[model samples]
Target: MKEELLFVRHLHVEFQHGGQKEEAVRDVSFDVGCGEIVGVVGESGSGKSTVMCAVLDVLPQDADVSYEQLWIRGGKSSAAMVFQDPSAYLNPTIKVGRQLIETILLHPEPVTEKATQQQKKNSRKRAWEHAEKLLEMTGIRNPEEIMKRYPFELSGGQQQRIVLAIALACRPSLLIADEPTTALDVTVQRQILDRLKRIAEETHTSVLLVSHDLGVVAALAKRILVMKDGEIIETGTAEEIFHEAKEQYTRELVEAARKHGSRSQDKRRISETILFQAEHLSFQYTKFHFLKKKSTEAVQDVSFFLRKGESYGLVGESGSGKTTLARMMTGIIEPSAGQILYLKERWKSLQKGRSKAQCQKIQMVFQNCAQALDPKRTIGEALTEPLEIRGGGMQDVWKTEAAETLFKVGLESEILEKYPGELSGGQRQRIGIARALMLKPELLVLDEPVSALDVTVQEQILQLLERLQREQELTYFFISHDLNVVRRICDRIGVLYNGRLVESGDAEQLYREPWHPYTKELMLSTLTADPKKMRRRRNVPELTSRGGTGSGEENGCPYADRCGYVMECCKKERPELYRFEDREVACFLYSEQHSGKRSKEYRMASQI
Candidate 1:
C-alpha cells in the first residue's frame, strides 16, 4: 500500500581481471517501499556492495553494469549515500559546516516567489541553521563547535555523524548507508542506529543498508536480501530469512551469525606462572604550540600481569588508550614512569645489546598485517630481518626458524619467495606472526589484529592464534574495541577508560555482571545477530553519556561524566582498584572492601 521508492529487475554486473571475465552481480531483483529499510548482506566478495555502488554510479569504469529494468521513482537527486569510511569520502580540507550548507544551497527547496540577493542571503543563513539541527539529529553533541572543525579533527564516530548530516542536508527521499557503523564502538553505534531509525520513521524516508554484519543490518532493516557469488540467494522478511532460509548459503550465513556473531563464554585453561608484569605504568606525550605547551597523559598508574600461556583481553571504546597501553607493553614505546619486569628481571629499554632476551621475549602483531608488511620485500626477507639486524651470526638459525614458524602457521614452504601482496589477508597475517616468532617470543601484543577482517576470516585467524598459543606456551596481550571478539579469544579481560583500568575479571563474568557503570554501558552496547534482541533494544533507554569521548582529560574517573551512578566525589578524585570476590573494580563504592561489606548499593549496581 506504500509508494514504491526504488525497483530493480535482472540487474547484472561484471568485471574483467587478468583477461578473465568475472560476474559481480547476477539476476538481482528487489524493491524498496517508502519509509522502509531494506538490508543487503553477505561476506566479502559477495557483490552486495557492488550493487549499491552501481546504483550510485560510483563503480569503476573497468566494470560493466546492465539491467533489464532499474528505476528510482523520484530520480537521482532525491537520494544520498553514506560510505563506510567517512574520512575517505569527506574532503579533509573543508570545514564541516561549510560543506553541510553547500549541499543545501545547491539543492534548495521549492520557492513560491522570486527572491532578491538579500532574501537569498537570509535563506542561506537559515540553511546553515538547519544544518546544525541535522547534526544534532544525528546525535552529535556541541553541534556549533563541531561545525567549525575539519574531518580529521573529529573522532571516527563524529566523522560518521557529520557525513550523515550531509546526507540528510538535501532532504533526500532515499538514504543509502554502506557499512555506516561498522568500525564504531558500541555506544556510538547505538546512537547512530537509533538516529537512523528515527529519521526513517519521522520523515518517511526509505533506506537501503548494505553491510556484511547481519547484526548491524538487522538492527534497522525490515526486509533482508542475501547475496552470494554475484547472485541472489534469498529474499524475505527478517524473521523468515533468519529462521527459515531455503538455500544452503543462506543457512550457512545464518548459522555463522548465530555461532560466531556474539562471543561465547570462554572455557579455556590458564597458567599460574606470572610471565610478565608492570607496576604503576604511566606514559605521557607533550605537544608544543606558539609559546605554549600541552600534554596528554595517555596511560595512568595502570598495572596488570599476564600469566604464562594466557590470553588477556583489553576492551575499550576507541581513544580510550587501549592501543597506547599495548604499544607500551610491546616496548615500541617506553612508559614515562614505572618498571617493566619479564622473567623477574626489569627491562629499562630495548637498546642494542642490552636485554636482547627481553626484546626477543616480547613481539607485536599490528592490525593490518598487509599494510604492516613491506610490499617490495618477499616473505623470506621479512622473516629474517629481525635476526639479520642483530649482527648476523645466526644465518642458519634464521633459516631454520623461518621454516619452522611458517610450518607452525600452516603455510606451505614455497610462500617464502612470494611478496606480501601476492598472498591473501590471512596468509599475510600469518607471515606477520612468523616474523614475530623469529626469536620465539613468550609474549605477543596483538592490537586489533582481526578487527578489519570478515567474520569467517576472523574465526580462522583466532583459531590459528589459539593453536599457536597452546602448542608454544605463549602469553597474549590482546587489544580491541570489539567486546564479542575479545570474548571469543581471551580467558580474562580488562576494561580501559580514559587511560585507566576501570575493571578486570574473567571474560564471562565481565560481560554478564559488569561492576563499573562504564562496563555496564559497554555490555549493553554490544550488538548480536538476534532479531528479537535488536527489536527489544529499540525500547532500551538511551545512554546518559554525552556524545564526544575523544578528549583526553585525566583529572578524575574518566567515565564520571557518563556514569549512571555519578556522585560529587566522582568528579573530584580518581578511584583505585578495589578487591571483589573474583575481580578488581576501580570504584569508590567498592573501595573499602577490607570489611567484607562494600557498599550494598554497589553490590546491587554490579548486578545491573
Candidate 2:
C-alpha cells in the first residue's frame, strides 16, 4: 500500500456574495498517495478549483471553510502551487533571476537561520546556481540569459515554466497544479506535463492537478477524481474514469470532451471559386532603439486562398503570428510587404480607406466573447448597433433582424434584454456570433473563437457555425491552437512556425500523417481522452522550448534546432514550402534532394 501524502475529510467551503451564502465545495474527501499524481476535473464553477484552494488554505477572507480532518504530512512549507496565469503571481518589474533567487532564499531546504554578510553572499551564489539548474530542468535553454530577462520578455509557455521552477524551489513534497497548461499550445502543454511527470518520479512528490480538460488529466494523472456541482461525482483510475464511469455526469463530461474536437466525416463539397487570397503577405513591427530602428517580422511571406463557403484553419503556438494574419485578413491591420486580394480586387491597406461594402463583408469574432461585447449596452443594442452604424435600416427593422439573428444562433429574444455581464460564457459567445451575423458577412475571421468555452459549449458553437455557413454560404478563416478543433471545422489547415507557413494541406490528412517536423510534433503532443493512446506521450522528449520559439539560429529553418532529423543544410538555408504528396511542407526531408536520405524519424512519423 502507498503512503498517504495528503489527507482531507468532509471538506466544505462557502462564500458570502451579496449577503447570500453560496456553496463552492461540499463534503469532499480525497487523499494523495506519496509520489502519486492525481487529477480532479470538472467544468467551470463545478468546485474543482475551489476544493484545491480550500485544501491550500488560500481562499479569500470572505470564504468560510469547515472540515473534519485536513492534513499535509510534511506541513505547510512542504507544498507549493502553480496557477493558470503565471503573470499574476510573478513580479513584472523584477528580473527572472532575482525573483527565482528570492524564492529560494525564503524557502530554505534545511530551514537555515539568519547569517552574517559573508555567509549571505555565499548562500546567494549557491541559490543562483540552484535556480539556473531548476530552469534547465524545465527545459529552458540559456538559463543564465533567461534569468536576466523580465517576465514580460518571455512567452506564455516560458512564463509558465519559470513559475513551475519557482514552485519547485522550495523542494515541496506536494505540488498542486491548477490549470497550468490550460492556455498553452499542444506541444508546450506536452512538455509541461512531461516535466511534471519526470519531477514526480525523480523526487517522489505528490501532485494534485485540477483542470477542465479530461485529455490533459488523463495524460498526467494515474488516479482521477471527477467533480461536479460541488461534489465528487466519481473516482477511479484514469482508464476507469474515462471508459467505465458509473455517474451520468461523468459520462456526459467525457462524451462532450471527446465530441468537441473530433474530425468530421461529412466532407462538404463547396465551390471552387476563390473568395479571398493573400499573396506573400507579411507584416513587420519597427521599434526605435535610441536613434536606430529594429524591425521584427510578425508575418512573413505567407500566401493562401480561401474558397467560397469553405473554412481554412491556421494552427500555431502563441507567438506564431496566427492572430496577426487574422487581423490582416479582417482589415484591422495592413501588410508591410504583400498584397491582399478580396474577390480578386487588390487592396493596399484597409485602414487607409475601404468601401463600406468591403468593411461589412468581412466581420471578425474574437476569442474573448465578453470583451467583444459592450458591458453597459444591452444585447439588443449590441446587435442593432452594427445596422445602426450602417445607417440604412429603421429601428423596428433592426430589432426584428436582431431577434432573427439570435434565433439563428440558437438564442432567444429574452436574451436581448440582458447585459453582457449577466449572461454565461456560452451565451456571450453566441451573442458575439449573432452580432457578427447582423452585418450579413460573406467571410468570418474567427480567432480562437471557441478556445475559452467549455467542451460541450464548444461543440454547440462549432455546429452552429457549420449550420450558418451552409445556410449563408459564409467563408471562414479560422485561427486556433487547438489542432483537433481545427480538424473538426476546417476543410484545409495551415501550420505556422515563427511567422512562416511551414505546412498546409487537407485538415484530415495532416492530422493523420503530418510531414513537417513541427506539424508532427504538434499532432503527437495533442492529448487525447484515451489513456492507453496517451501513455507514450509522457516519454516523448522535450523537442522545443516551451516559449514557442525554439533555439534556432537566424536566417535558417526556425525549427532546425528542435527537429530530430535536421540536416546540415537546414541550418544554412531556409526551406520553402515544397509539394509533398497532397500537402506542402517546408522541410528538406520531403524535398527531392534529401528524399533518398529520409531519417528513421521521418519514417516513424509517416507511419503514425
Candidate 3:
C-alpha cells in the first residue's frame, strides 16, 4: 500500500455566533497520500475551505474544532495554504519580495556563526532568489521585476502566481490551495494547473485543492472528496466520482458540468436589427509626463453590435481590453475615434450624451460587490438610489419594486436593512444584481458580475439573468473570461485579442468551430469536467506557439506569431475579415475563399 502524507478522521467544526452554536463543518474524513493530489469540491458554505483552515490551526477564536484523528507523514507536521482571493491573503501595503521573505523566515532554524547583519542580508537575498525561482517555475515572465512590485501593481492572474509562489516557498510536506485559479483567465488557469501538477511530481508534495470548479478538480485531482453543508458526502477516484456519483449533490454538480458541454447547441439566434452599435471604436489613455505627451491605445478600431433582448459575450485574457471595451460600450469612458449608436440614434460622443436618464437606461453591475456598493449605505439605500435619481412619484411604489426585484434575485426582503458588510460575498453579489435590475434598464453591462460567485450561486444568477431577459426584454453585454458561463448565456460571441475582434459569430458556432488561433487557444485551455476528457484534451495540440508568433495582428492576423498555420504572407500583411456563411473569421487560411458556395462548404467542414 502507498504511504499517506496526511490523514483526517471524523473532523467536526462549529462556531458560536450571536449566542447560537452553528455547525460549520460536520464529520469529514479524507487522506492525502505522498505526492498525491486530493480535491475537495463544494459550493459556498459547504465547509471545504473551513476544513482546510481548521487543519492549519487558523480558524477564528470563536470557532470550535475537533477531530478523531489527524496525522501527518512525519512526526513534525508543517503545512502551508494558498487562499482563493490573493488580495485578501496578501498585505497590500508590503512589497511581494518582503512578504515572501517574512513567510520563509517564520520556520525557525538556527543561523550560521556569522554577524547578525550578515545573516539578515543573506536571508533577504536568499528569499529573493527563491521567490524568483518559484515564480519562474510558475511560468511567470520577468520574475525579478515582479518580485519588486506590490500586490496592486500586478493583474489578478499575476498576483495569484505570486501567492502560489509564496505558499510553495516553505516547501511544506502538505500544501492547501483554495480555488487557486478561480480568478485567472482560461489560458492562465491552464498554465497554473500545469505548474501545480509539475510541482507535485517534482517535490512529491501532497496537494489538497479546494474548488467549486469541477473542471479544475478533474484536471488535477487523483482522489475526489465531495462536501456539502460541512459533511463529506462522497469520496472516490476522479473517474468514479465523475461517472458514478452516488450522492444527489455530487450528481447535481456532475450534471452541471456536463450540461456546459451541451449548452453550445442551445444558443439563441441574434436579431438582424442592431440595438447597440460601435463603429470603429478607438480609445486611448493619456500618459502624463514632464517631457513628452503620449497616449496608449487601450481599444483600437473595435466594432460590434448587440440586438435587442440579446446577450453578447466578450472574452479574452486579462489585459486583453475586455473591461476597457465594456466601459466604452456603457458610456463609462468616451471613445476617441468611434461613435456608439443606440436605438438608431448616434450619440455625438459618450461624454457629450452623458445624462442621468441615459445612465439609467444603461446600468452596470461590477465584479466586486463589496467595493461597488457604498460601505456606509444599507442595501435599501443602494437599491433606492436609481429610483430616487429618476425622481419617482411614489416612494412606496419604488420600495415595492425594489423588494420584488430582490425576491426575484433570490434574496429576502429583510436583507434590505443590512449593510454590505453583513452579507456574504454571494449575497452581496445578488444585491448588486438586484440594484441593477431596479433601474429597469434597456441594457445591462455585466463586467465579471458572476466571476466572484460560487458555482451554485453562479447558476442561480445565470438563471435569473435569463429569466429577466425573457420577461423584461433586457439586453446584456456580458463580459467574462469563463467560457463555460459565456457558452451558457450568450446569443453571440466575439473573440478579442489585444484590442481587436478577431472572430464573431453565434456562441454555439464559435465554440464548435473557432477559426481564429487565439479563440481556439482559449477554448482548448478550458478544463473539462471529466478526467478522461480533460486528459485527452490536454494532449490535443495548442493553437499557438511560444511568444504567440502567429496570432492575428492589428493590420493582419493578430495571432500570427502564435498560430500553428501561419504563412509567409501572414507576416507581411494582415488578413481582412472573410465572411463564411453566418460566421466571420479573420485568417489567411480562408483569404482565397469567397462568401458563396465554397464558403458554405468551408463552414460545414469547420462545423460552425
Best by lDDT: 2
Task: Give residue 347's lDDT in candidate 3 (0 to 100).
Answer: 60
Q: Cα lDDT of model 2 overall?
A: 0.87
Which one is best on TM-score?
2
Which residue pairs collide, candidate 1? Answer: none
Candidate 2 residue pairs that clash: none
lDDT of 3 by residue, 241-268 (tens): 9999889889888887766555634334
Q: Tens digit of lDDT per residue, candidate 2, span 113-207?
A: 76778888888999999999999888887899999999999988899999999999989999999999977888889889989988889989899
Show model 1 residue runs off by greater than 4 Å: 18-20, 112-114, 261-269, 351-354, 391-403, 538-555, 593-607
TM-score of 1: 0.92
Order of models, best lDDT first: 2, 1, 3
Clash count, predicted structure 2: 0
Ranking by TM-score: 2, 1, 3
